[model samples]
Target chain A: MIGLYLTAPYLVYLVIVYAVPIIQGFRISVLDYVYAAPGASVPQPFVGLKNYRKALSDPLLRRSFLNILEFLAINVPLTVILGMTLAAVLAKLSRMKTFFRSAFFVPYVTASIAVIGVWYFLFSQGGLIDHVLGSWAPNPSWLVNSKLAMVVIALEVTWKQLGFYVLLYLAGVLLIPDSLYEAASIDGAGPVRQFRAITVPALRNITILVTTLALIVGANLFAEPYLLTGGGGPNGATMSPALLIYQKGVEQGEPGVGAAIGVLLTLFILLVAGAGAGARRLVQAREAA
Target chain B: MRNGQYGRTLRRLTTYGFVTLGALASIFPLYYMVVGSLQLRADSAFSGLIPKAGNLGLQNYRDVNKAISLLPSLGNSAIFTLGTVVLTIVVGLPAGYALARLRFPGKPAVAGGLILVLVLPFQVMMIPLYILAVRDYGLADNYLGMILPFAVNPAAVLIFRQFFISLPDELFDAAHIDGAGEVRTLLLVAAPLTKPAILTASVITFIGPWNEFLWPFLITKKHSMQPLAVSLGEYVSTNAATAANPYGVILAGACVLAVPVIALFLVAQRYFTSAALGSGVKE
Candidate 1:
């Protein structure tokens, strides 16, 4: 069929770029993984999950997982709370909606590399934020402080990404009927009460969506750590699994080890994202009731 | 009535106060970035929240030009973005059209494959793809090497297919009944309807690679071959970290890397509405 001809390019593209590589990734993960150039006389003997065992016990890789855990602890709540609250406010504004929307949204469109520079400037020692904080700032700067560096990265991710999530929340908020708010108001409920009972409950599904989306993105925290922390620095406090993959696999040319990290990270993402998807369906079913 | 009036005023004030503060928080960094780029300062920090006309100049930009060579990198970014976007649309549009309208035998299989790959993060394939680009394919430091992995986007195909499928079946049926060939129908009839999808796909695709750093950074060992983001990324990690951190130069590079996407956002923002962003996130 003409259909087969038409669709072949993408299928072929996916095969070469995604499927085969996934297979290759699994193969490499189980091998000893030569660091040699193409066609070099090196034997990559089957290691049979030796790399996986090493990756699990590897300090930086283990730290990378905990690093994301800390990142998620800061990023998820901040993103959801800030996003929906901003959305709630935006919903109330009858004027300058477009202006406010675009204001929040510009950073989302800007390159992380570009704005990570601003983040660097803002959080650098004696910079605007530090000057504003005025002696409350951490010693050795936020960039160099082991404890604060990950926190800064989390905030940067939340700030750059919060706008898009706010828009998502805004769309969800706009769908809840005005009549519910009206009824709540008539029942002697103030704005806060109405939001608590009507708005929050109505947007429950969106909150799940927003939270999981944030979780999925945060798990693969790469550029923010890579660029902002200069490839996960300050004693590996900012090291992420994704960055570790680049370092071990690409930069260090230890494909087997990197592939092991990659496979584990992939499994972690799939499990969490899968659970999120399942939760979404459960929420939908409950709402449909 | 007076109590109600007081409450109303308080609520409005709080609403305005929250939104104003949030908006300022969101947008000020960019305004400051532009300000930071233009200023000449010894320490290379932000001069202040506001730019003083007396302190500002093109000196940092000049330094950026000398340091990173902005023009060639911009050209490289443009070429990389164009290659990926054009190739994606070329490959994806036809495939989408076929899957949506034509009776392909593997249509179900393709759809299943898409669902399977929907949540397939690029991180999963980064290693092997890097190997393919660098060692196996010998594409290291090459333009095609930098662009090849991103050339075909599954999300773009999915978006195009969904958009095409949304159109009425009667329309495609009529074109087929007219004996117009599939290609002709796509160009003349179906293609016109796909403008929104095309625009959405193109813009979304543009931003992803336009702002990308890591992959290209991996592909190119040479500074000259690196795109704008990679060059700036390399700079910030190295030169920008030293005691001689060039604040103006860094922001100047950031400005070059940032301005195009921001400009595109401003010009075509209507297409970047919540609906499109929702779909675009699949990228």
Candidate 2:
């Protein structure tokens, strides 16, 4: 009793700070509410799945979902490949390993606003990229063009995240015993062949881990496109589900709809995360067996 | 054998070249940001990798300061980030210790729940949490509003727990024989051994709060309450015209925001590298 009392402040803090918001969030999803008309009335008629249906059927919402799917499809593989290659190379360096690692990871630590700012300049018309390209051809506004806008945003996310993936891959690669490489070398297996046969296979689990985590995060894309294209510019070309919820809830003052989108997004993320965890466990189990 | 050695040297050279090139590509934008930030507004059009002498000036910093309260926003960020780090470490350490060391009931359930929390995306809860913060808690537009939601990151807890679990049981047995209670044991004996994990957790939590944009942007509307990220966003948005978009000032802000974490990581670079690698491996 004394121990519980002593720790009561911490427990209360967690319950109030962490748990209540989640519970309240769910409750608000069921209740039809608007932020604009505060203190309008209580018992604000529960509108069971109406908000969810609206969120699901809305064309803007559907487009946002499609945009996220497109982002995942394009960015995931590129990040994984780039990260693995960099990690593999870095792992071999006998000197300057720390410098290279820090350099790569620097972008990950920098503010997203700063990253977007730099990228905006790079991708803008008559900016760095355009300046380089204009010597050969006419320049187009990267952010204005819908297709190009998506690509630019994807590139920004990849830049920020690739370092993290490199770190993960380095960890995965370092775990493989050097004896395997030595044995492969003794067998006259060249570097490329050894990497393909041993390194790739050994890194299978980490690859899956990275891919699944990236997929989950990629689907929640918000800040890059939001900053780049000004929150789904030029006919909502790059809007994600997360941004859609923000728009509905904050911008449009429709809390219920926003909450509904939040619930759906949560469900989608959970489903993917659960599948990934299960798959990882199965792989581990099989390997152990 | 000579041909084989030549081929091996060629492969090594290619690997080194590729790695260097990749690092350069990764670091270039950041380099551009820094170089551009030092340039005068008129010279913002310079497309080169380096900033020239005349163009390199502190005018952008002056303009940024005059235009936006960059310092205050930085202070707000520090306050929020520091608060988050302290709260997370304090709350997380004990819970993590208990879950790791104690033969408590429902141990697996607690551990599993923490892992699930780690993988769960905060985007899903953003709207609902915002409403709750505003309505129920009255935390909207307040410092606590931003700090509280992030006070207990499950990832930090999990990492701490994992580190604690790896400690030898003999330490706890010795502490018990010395008549030290669990709390004392954690604070005195266990914690000293878990510094690496604690530092790693602190670094991660600090970075998350420091660079966080969406939550702060959503929760806080007042300019004074905004962090550096939110302020920078507003600065770019509002001053898109008449300001020449001082890349130098923006980069200065970026550097200001980035330097502390970068330095912390550099100081603890070994721990960070190990933690980054270690966390990916299975228990």
Candidate 3:
């Protein structure tokens, strides 16, 4: 009775805010629900699987998903690798550890739009990157070019989020007993060998955690493209599925398509999370064996 | 011994080298933003990687404030973030304590549901929430709509639950012996013991709403009602009037949005690192 009493408020909140919205979202996605405009009457007919089918078939939606995939391919690996490397380096430091950790984390803590502002100037025409590159580079328009814009967004995101994953990785690194490293050193193992043998194996769980997190963050690539490239940029090059959902749902008045896109994005995130969890179980089982 | 000294020196050099370089890369953008904000000239947008003494001023900040409603937006951010922190602590603590201490029948299921909430993205639930807040409740332009959805955070609950579970049972038993009710025992004992947990949860909770753009942006369509994040997003992307001092104004806007959080982080730096390092990531 006490447990139920204590948990009731949170349960109520979850039901209203989270559970209800998700169910409503599923319902909206299957209907032809254009948002009702101010002082206008509109009919929202139940369209069954039409929105999902449209999302699957629509070229822009497909392209948006593809764009996010490309982004994930670059972002997830880069964030995890850079975060892992930096964490390993920071973990070894005996002096000024807090300084470097705090410095890296500043970007992570800052609002995305704020940092996006900083990055926009950095990569725009006659900006720092262009000023450095000079006229030797042909039209060094980072945000203008489709491929390069995606790369820049990835770099910005990786830079911002790297510190967070670093903290997580650092936690994983600290969990490994020092005695193992001492034993490895006594056996004539070098730093690289010790890192590979001890640090990597010990970080199996954390690696999964970081990758899963990075995948989720990468998939929800909205504000960067929205702020930097003006919501999809030149010819919808950097249009992430999240941005697409917003554009179609809110801005363009097609909430059904937006909800359909949301449903798909959730499934993709769940798939990645499931795989990460499964992989962790497999690794742990193997370790036990 | 000589070889060991050499190896140690090399290791130290590599460590400092990588760490310093990474830190510099991390801080360079922020440095540039501040410097660019100070230097108002359009031509010399980035006045060298090293900022000149003469090229700095406070006018652009004033201009940004004039151009957009920076102070009001920041005020909105503060209210929203503070409300979230308060609500998270108020609602999460009891639930977390229950999960930790009480003999709940559906404890395992509740715990699983909390973890599921952590994994689920906000984007997944955006559409329905937007409609509900706007259509059913007519809370589109209100702070309550923005604060309510995120008030009961699963992560805060999980953090508090972990902290409460690790507390000595004797304290609670002693409270019971003194005939203190559950509420009083929780208020007097468990609550006070959770300072570190509170700080951790507060910081974590603060960062989300403080930096959140999408939901606030969606709900509060009116510019005056928007938070700093949404306001900055609008100013940078769409505001045409600020194009006169584009770099300076935009950077100034960025600075306003970032400075508060950055200042808070700097002041409470010790709490952050220790909290993250020591207690987190057991799961």
Candidate 4:
């Protein structure tokens, strides 16, 4: 009875709030749901996988997936490499480490909307970027230019997220024993050689972990693009899968299509996450052998 | 020896130089935001790295206030964030404890499922959740609509569960001998012991609700109901064509929104880093 009392509130909250909605969400996906036609009898017709078929067939959906793929391709590697490099420096720093660490990490803690606000100013016409460009070339309208818009958004994500990756990498680097570096140094290995042999190998798991997280976060890109490009503007140049899902589902009132896209995106994330876990296990086994 | 010393100096200089450049690249956008916010409309046209000190006035700040009810929006954000944090912790703590300590059936499956949920995009589940909220539950444009869906954070529960599992079993046994029930023991014992984990979870929970854009934007259309992020986003989007971008006022707003989390981080920097990184590890 006591145990039941202890667990009841939490159990009830989770079931009612978290689990039920998630399960109900699946059910709603099957129905021809319309938020506006709320009182209509049998509002959502049970159309099994029809939404999924429409979503899969949509060119916008395919394009958004491709856009997310391109974004991940650039962002994942840049953030990881930059983060690892900064972490390496931070690990070696003997003075002002905390200050430097905090400075880099301020962005991660700041609101994403705020960060996007700052970027909007910098990337907009006659803003910082344009100001610089006016010195040499004609000012390009970044928010409207389809090709440049994606790159600008990508850069913004990298800048905001690099600090987080740095912290993660720093934790991994700190775990490497100093004696390993000493041993390499005594063996006539230079700093580069030490890092190549010791730091890289030791940080393998951290790399995989950070990369997977970056990919997941990157795939779910919404606020930045939504705010930055005005909901994937310039003919949908920077539209992510998440934004596409929101636009189709909420704005267009197509819950079925939205759920279908959502499932597809979830599957994509799951495959990446699974591959990462598998890779970590493989690395650990190889190291043990 | 002298040559080697010179080489070491050169290497140190190179390292410092590279790190400094990266740091500047990381922080330069923020610097621009600050400078741009301060400049007058005419000065803003120049877009130089440095702001003309005279052009730095309260005009932007005044404009931002006139344009949006930033203060009220911030209040709404705080209420929502605080409410969400309390709800998550109140519910998450016991559930985490149950999963960690109790020999419940489907424990491993529950644990694994929670982890899977963490990686699943909120976008996918959003439509169904929204339909349930508006159509079935009739929570449209209401605070409950926003709060209920977000209350049970999977990540918080996972972190709390991890922390709970590592706790010494003796504490529970001792409390049990004293005739303290599981609820009493959890409230008095486990909850206090997991301070760092709790604080970390609270900070993250606060940040998510405070910084959340899409959900609030989707759910609430009323200016009174909107939080700081959505309100500010709407303000910027609508006011983009104005001569001066009102950078300072926006920065001020951003700064206001940031202050609590920044302060929390500063107070618990070391523990915050450890807890964040520790919970992130797979094992």
Candidate 5:
């Protein structure tokens, strides 16, 4: 068919690059594969889940996974709430709406490299942040502090992702018929009451979409922590699973274990996404009932 | 009535206050990066939040330009990003068209697969991709190696498919009645209507590779062959010690890497928000 002919190139590409590599990655994970080792000319031998077992047992990996959960806990709600509030405010504005929207979106457009640089200068010893807050906190060395480093990373991610989430929320906000708000106002509902009643319910699907997207993006947190803390802070505090996989697999020359970590991370994302979708469905069905 | 008017005015003022503060928080880092980069080495951290007028200079930028092999890295980024964009449009367009217009075997499977691929992280495929590009085919340090995997972008495909699906079938049938072949009709007719789709896909695709760090770092071994994202990372991390003014030089480097991306976003800003909306894709 003409359709198959048109699709052939892309199907070939997906097979070669995406699908094949995914399958091959599993194969490599199960084998004692070190592609870069000296005289690793022979095919790797099958080790049968040993690499996975080792990755599961790795204290550093466990710590990294725990770090992701902590990040998710703080980041997901903050992003949604902040994003929604900003979108609502922007929607209601009669003046400087475009200016404010563009201003808020600058961070999302800027690359992580530049963004992290500014943050580094801000949080470093004797920097502007320290100069300002030195009296109260007394020179908070952000990158070195284990707990504080993770918190800062979460803040950085939230700031970076806020704009995209805002755009999504704005689109959802625009779809809510103004009549609903008008109706609420006629009933003597204040701004707060109208927002609570009309805005929240109108944004149900968008909220689910944004939250799920946030979860996936949170799980893939690599750039900020990697750039900010040189991949891990003191005591492996700021380490993320993606960072851990890159460190062990690529930096440390243990591809087998790295592939295993990748596999686990994939499964973890699937499980989270599945749970989110199921929860959305249940909530929807309940509301329908 | 006067009291009620005063309360409403007060509420409006507070809302503006909150929005301005949030916007300032969002943009403060970028402002700092620019101001800090322009300041003298000794004056870098000592200055207040607003940069002093007299101390600003381009010395740090000149120093960064000299220190890192910036031109080559930028050129590499250009090649890598431009190559991915062209390839995505070329390959993704036809496939999208096929799914939207032409009847095909296994259509549902392919559509489902595309969505499934969207959910999976690139990290899952990265191991084999690394080996395949680096060792098996000897594409390490080559632009093709860096560009090929990302070129087959699912997001672009989905965007294009969404656009093409909305087009009237009569248009394609008209072309066909005139004895125009599928590729000709596609090139002349179907693809032209998708300017918004093209812009959205190109901008989104451009941003990914332009600011990409990990895979390019993995693929290109030599510093000379590296893209801006990778080289910028290395220069900031390891070579920060070598510069006379670490903050100034590194911030300058960040500026160099960010300027083009920011400019592109500014130019295409209108198209970006509206086009995604037009296509019925929610960001």
Candidate 6:
């Protein structure tokens, strides 16, 4: 009972913040939450999945979803591989370990919104990156190139976030006992062999954790695309679901449709998380077998 | 032995070389943002990569300060971000302690509910939250509205719970013997020892709203109340033509906004890394 008393504040907050809004989110999804003029009462009539049906057929919405798919197709593998590789190498270092760790982490620690402007400046016409690429630079530039725009967004996301996953993997890598590696070397195993046989197997749970984190991040991406692409520019080539939600719900004054997108995005995230958990279990069970 | 020594030297050099390259890539944009902020407008594109020392000036910084009401917007971000950090810790600490230390019914239900909530994205709840606060409460144009939804942070709650659980049971038992209740025990015994959790929670929570664009942008359209990130965002997207050098002016504001966050990280980074390890939560 004392525990209940102590936890009362959170319970109340949970209802007001999470539970009520979540329920209201579902409610708004099914109703036409037409924007009313101030001090005017508007009755929201039930639309019965009209918003969802519209969402299914909406090309821009469809484009947004496809954009994110292409985004993760580039982002996920790059983040995981680079993160693991950096962590593995850093774990073996004795000199300037602190310096390397802090230096790598600075970008992740800095706000993406703050540094995204720098990416814009760099990638703009005849900017640092364009100047560096010389004649090989895309004619309209990378940020504006419909073909290469999403790739730039993904790479920007990777550059800003690689440190975070590196730190996570580094933590996991450190927990593998030095004895395992020493034993591997006694059998004349090289560093690559030791890493594969010893480090990889020991860090399975963290790897799963890292992959799920990367996936969740991929699913919810907003700030970079919003800023870097200047609000999904050059024909919505860089649009993300979060930006779409903002446009429909807040900007476009169609809360019902926005809520529908929100509902779909949430469902997608839940499904991905569930699938990730299942994969981890399957891997664990296989090891047990 | 000489061959072995040479091979080991080569391997170590390879490791250092790889890490340094990654670190340089990581840090360059920030360095460029600050350096570029100082470069004269005419110097851009012509001298983009290696900044000339003599040509750099504080003109862009001054221009940005004037361009977006940088000082006032900075104050708004400070208030908004600080308000969020304080409320998150205050509300999260007690709930986390109760979950970890106190015996209660429905504990499993609460835990599971927390997990369900964890998987939830803020984008999912953002609509109704906007409705609830902006429509129902009429808190549009208010910092409190911008701060509230994020205040009851699930990550902070989880971080605190995980931190409290790791504390030995003996501390709580002694507090109990001294006639301290659960809340009192947390206040006197646990809060002091949980600096790491507090710092980690503050770091993550502070970054989200301090740097968030959408919520504050939705809540308050008033220039005085808009956070620096939103103002800078508007500048980035729409208002670039107002400045002499749009690139430098925009980056100047970004640099100002980033200074405090990066400074805090530099000062307390060990707490950040160790705390993330301890809590299993991300910013």
Clashing pairs in 6: none
Q: Which consecutive 10 residues in model 2 chain B have the weakest lDDT in total?
A: B274-283
Candidates in order have lDDT scores of 0.83, 0.76, 0.82, 0.76, 0.82, 0.81
Q: Can you write out model 2's per-residue Cα lDDT over A21-103, one digit (the tens) per residue?
A: 67767777888875643455555569998888888888887777677667777777888778877888889998889899988
| Models ranked on TM-score | 6, 3, 5, 1, 2, 4
Residue-level lDDT tens digits of model 2 in B45-109: 54456667766777777777777777898899999999999888887877777777776555565
Best by DockQ: 6
Write one digit per residue (lDDT tens) for candidate 1, span B141-220: 98889888788666788778878878998887898899999888889999888889988888878888899987898788
TM-score of 4: 0.90
Over A1-289, each residue of candidate 6 has an lDDT whose tens digit, in order, gives 8878767787887787788889999999999888776679989999998999987777777788788678778887787778888999998898888888888888876776777888888888878887777899898888888888888888988888788788888888888888988998999999999888887777666666666666666656777777787777768888888888888888888999999999998777667668778987898799899
Better of 1 and 2 by DockQ: 1
What is residue A287's positional error in candidate 2, in angstroms?
14
Residue B238 of model 6 has an lDDT of: 81
Question: What fraction of native interface contacts is shared by candidate 5?
Answer: 0.63
User: Candidate 4 residues A105-186, lDDT tens each?
Assistant: 8777778888887777677667666766676533358888877788788888888877777887888888888999898888
Estimate candidate 3's alpha-carbon lDDT, on a 0 to 1 scale: 0.82
Best by lDDT: 1
Candidate 3 per-residue C-alpha lDDT over A179-256 given as tens digits, one digit per residue, 9 for 90 to 100: 999999999999889988988778766777767666777667889988898788767788888788888888888889
Candidate 1 residue spans exceeding 4 A from truth: A39-41, A186-188, A274-289, B2-6, B42-47, B241-245, B281-283
| Alpha-carbon deviation at B42 in model 5, angstroms | 5.3
List, residue by residue over B57-160, the lDDT tens digit for candidate 5. Answer: 99998888888778988999999999999999999989999888888897887777777777667777777788887877678889999997788678888888
| Tens digit per residue, CA lDDT, model 3, B185-222 | 88898888899888888887788899998889899988
| Model 6, span B205-265: residue lDDT tens | 7777887887888788888899998898887878876777988888888899899888988
Comparing only chain B with the true structure, the TM-scores of all models are 0.89, 0.91, 0.92, 0.87, 0.90, 0.92
**Lowest summed lDDT window (length 10), candidate 3 chain A:** A131-140
- DockQ by candidate, in order: 0.65, 0.50, 0.65, 0.53, 0.61, 0.66
Which candidate do you rate higher for TM-score, 2 or 4? 2
What's the true lDDT of residue B230 in model 4? Answer: 83
The interface root-mean-square deviations, each candidate in sequence, come to 2.1, 3.0, 2.1, 2.8, 2.4, 1.9
